[model samples]
Target: MRIKDAGDMTSKAQETTAAVSRQRHRGQPYVGQPMERLEDAAILTGRGRYGDDLGVKPGTLHAAIVRSPHAHAELGRIDATAALDAPGVHAVLTGADLVAWSRPFVVAVKAPMEQWALAMDRVRYVGEPVAVVVAESRALAEDALDLVRVTYRVLPPVVSIESALDEDAAILHPGVGANVVSDRRFRYGEPEAAFAAAPHRVTLTAHYPRNTCTPIECGVVIAEFLPGDEGYDVTSNFMGPFSLHAVMAMALKVPANRLRHKAPRDSGGSFGVKQAVFPYAVLMCLASRKAGAPVKWVEDRLEHLSAATSATARLSTLEAAVNAEGRILALSYDQIEDCGGYLRAPEPATFYRMHGCLTGAYDIPNLLVRNRVVMTNKTPTGLVRGFGGPQVYFALERLVQRIATQLGLDPLDVYRRNFVAADAFPYRAAAGALLDSGNYQLALTRALEDGGYDELKRRRDAARAEGRLYGIGFAAIVEPSVSNMGYITTAMPAEARKKAGPKNGAIASATVSVDLLGGVVVTIASTPAGQGHMTVCAQVVADVLGVNPADVVVNVEFDTHKDAWSVAAGNYSSRFAGAVAGTVHLAALRVRDKLARIAASQFGCTPAEVEFADGRIARHGAPEFALPFARVASNAPHWSPQQLPAGEEPGLRETVFWSPPNLEAPDENDRINTSAAYGFAFDMCGVEIDRATGRVRIDRYVT
Candidate 1:
């Protein structure tokens, strides 16, 4: 019955999907094809230019950071005299120097907790930077680190959610007065009434441990303080959420325009860990100022693991209101996030990032959320793979399975009963997420058949009969991408947010130009950390211009001073496909339209009658009469400005700044569409537990 209702609801959406499919197949030949990445040849052959590959400058010096060994402690005198007297030592930077030279990094929450690039009078985490040594070489700097005498007075540390919340727990930030920094409660759709009237309720409490992405390359920064008022020039492999660039500039006490920041063409990989490098970038900038030379700091493996950012450790308690038919009607969430020792700039974001999709793929209409951000004696938290989705879904899916058990129904049946109806898209979720499009029921049905669900169940039953522990599982999720910049502002109270001004949209920029020699060049601010932005950009631009993908030149390097970018630019939140590529396509279209107009005028036809294909522009119905694409492109600049169309610029260049129209600021009730697009994924897996070894082995998996 549920499947039939879903099929009935999907008729209109299926028609729309078919129309879109046909439209995509019309002129986008290069886009959907499996073209190899153009960046691989250089990267795979070891010719890639990562952060460290920038090479040493004439007066380059290396830096070694000294970190606190105690989880929580009061700082005492740091005696760097011996380190300064050591061979090849240039200078030593202590917390006092940083306090005098820079300001604490700006954080999102309203709490007055101060976090500087280096620890000030107190250290709250084990790996917090206490001092930095600059020397002639990296090894010398490292050697000098041990020579610097430091004193510390150990303090009680809050290491867990319970400890952090305890009345007697030592406060990490005295100004905040408590370990919990941000807390908010949101109610949507009368969840109280739904839960009270429901026939059954299921609850789950789960913990997601702190974790980090281990990229092949860690943090690296090279900074040079220009003489006098010229300000700072810094290069780093910091794959931004470029909002931090402004934060860094503020901390460095320089105007945004004065700080010139650049990322190398290739980053080893970031996932999301590299955003934390902004703090270190500012640290090295100040180091360069003290050392009176260009300073380079390459984070060693130990430093990277010990001090670098990690995903927030989340504690989620979820309750589901269900009907006798196994349909979930409402949900209540009490979520506590451990953001480590400091409330990093984007700390509370991990809680709100997935707020819109809190209920996951279900069609639950009522939701109540109690979100809290707590601090503990651990590494600070920032973006990581799946940012907040994994933690949210972990508890949500578990609650669904528990609902099935309580109702004595099959888990799969319970899932199908609650999936958002296909025809109801663009469905607005309870928390204000606009689920754009999907056929959830059909997707799950197909996944089950393709994954051989019945066969797996039979195998599992047989193994259980033989006293072996085996199980089959399935999960469905609504994956959001192209994050709206305004969603972070939701962390603030609605009244306070009004004073802060309205924030929304994920802005991206791209530039398409035809060189004087008639070669196409594409420049984008989407910093690709090995995600193949170059390949996709080329494929997109080439399709729009009707040229071979190989002929299109795509540049993915980012420069704050040169590239047209916004605070929302840079990799994270899966923005490349929707925001970055969208801008590239728009810019390419502008260039393509210009060339088509030029060809139209030469052919004595309307611009609408012009067509581009095979590197040539011709009349739509008359392919025989065409001009080479290069000739049409070059005519505007090289030979024929007088013959150009009226009001047409005499250059083949177009720049586009794009953001999806659907993104909007949070409403008065704090409901927001946190992302521009919501994608869906369904996975089924078969696992067997090794009775003796206590390990689980995946026998089969399908997605």
Candidate 2:
């Protein structure tokens, strides 16, 4: 479906405002209040169940992977005779086993690259898994790993973006014919005309390095190949974009329903790093099948750093068309993203995640984007903190600073001049992002006043007079969250996407139910690493049901077979607040409405005339006529079905799936809202540089 026009959006916004007003009048006491996380007590007390803690089944075998030290090489022969005969060795698996038991994972782009858990004919990167040794214990598996021998013929490696782009660079995927996997160009407005007519222009190139967050608990997986058609039961600390569950099932050569994937109660942390653990989960399932027992693997720190995924290293060149007043008229971007070794799924995304907000907080009306995804002999890239924000904004904001210097204006003034007007939202960006609501100018003014901008400038000037290097910097950004699932499709061209059918929306699922004892229960599909999801869920349910937050029980453990989850579920994109929590609130509202109906029947009043407050239900105007919440809730299903409202269901359970209405697939011109909501952030910081030691210290900072 197409997105609504500006007029329709304005009307919808008015309706939403009215609903929020009614909700405020109804009172929500617990929602915005801060409370200690419910998971913290269990975690601090060592009672939390992590991935390694869940593989306690008897006869569970430990697995250690043998990796290739060479970055690029042709696979020759794998002789596992010695390792297979080693003490406690159950089985040894090579590339041959992977070929016989599994299929290659599906790629997101229209590239013919085949990625398997184990290296087959050729290894593309260092630390690529070559073999797996399963044994009674981890030590034995490690010992056996040393005895497995494999022969390789080394080839010249394409390790850098510059090297990969060279005309004669070694082809990593012969089937695709080049190192560049996905390349596309897009134009939103008349950038050529704007550039020719501009009074001033500034261009700059910047590089964002590849990096990864190290979680305290590394990747861990327990896989058991159930006998016959029972399929696979795999548990991991693989916080997802659970969309990969189908990919894992395909690689295992089984139907999606046959794969029972689950996450443990607690993962040390993900920060978007754990999504890459799906390949290993599939690998362990094959190891279990071969060894005739359950197989478990825990990644060590070295393995985690070397083989685990990192954010894409991006090289961006930005050019801006500006007038004399430092107001940007248009922008052009030429970006090359390094997705090391393979074009892993959900990638090339680093180039497009910020596509909608490419202009940052500016009011530029024209834009041109040239995006390229290059493959190199390094660890494959995936998600990390801020996804693509740092890479995009680094170049965009730096160009703004350069523009300020070129115009002989203050950087802050340039920002103020280009800022989208406060009343101009719900704004439509040059590239198809429908910015819902933001007051960029107001936010920037507040930040400058609160950060003591004048005082910072005086301090910098005083330090510079003493032969010291001190400077103050400012930036305004649009933080996009609750990502639409279909935004990734923008990587494909408009025609390709059309052939594949329209994909849109960022759907989240939640369930609210009342227990037999009248306790409130909330279940969410999101897997929390450190975020206080349980506490937030409790607060939402409590406020909806008019009960104490402590009385609500929240369950976050996710099981593919049992939970009411969509492919859009799981914890990334900062979706907890806008998507997941919104769904939880929706589900609670459903239950509240059902309870209100039951209460109104007993109070002999209309459902809208019933009031829910302080663990009791009463007629709105008659406080003397009321019933305890537990009594009314318990009697509905257990003691008195006859007292229930006509046509009302007996149980107090509700499941809800929610997606923002504005999320639409990329249009004919490839314009789309990549996220459900847009939040504004203005940052100002003062830094001092040590001339002799080259150390930089932050003296003041505000966001």
Against the unseen true structure, what C-alpha lDDT does each candidate score? 0.88, 0.87
Q: Write the per-residue lDDT of candidate 2 for residues 544-630, one digit (tens) a residue.
A: 788766667899888999999988888998999988998999999998898888888778888898777777878898988788878
Over 4 Å off, model 1 = 1-28
- Candidate 1 — which pairs collide? none
Clashes of 1: 0
User: What TM value does model 2 have?
Assistant: 0.95
TM-score for each model:
0.95, 0.95
Give Cα distance to truth, residue 385, candidate 2, Å: 1.1
Q: Tell me model 1's lDDT, rounded to 2 decimals.
A: 0.88
Give the alpha carbon lDDT tens digit for every residue of 203-287 in model 1. Answer: 8999988888999999999999999898899999998899889999999999999899999999888989998898999999999
Clashes of each: 0, 0
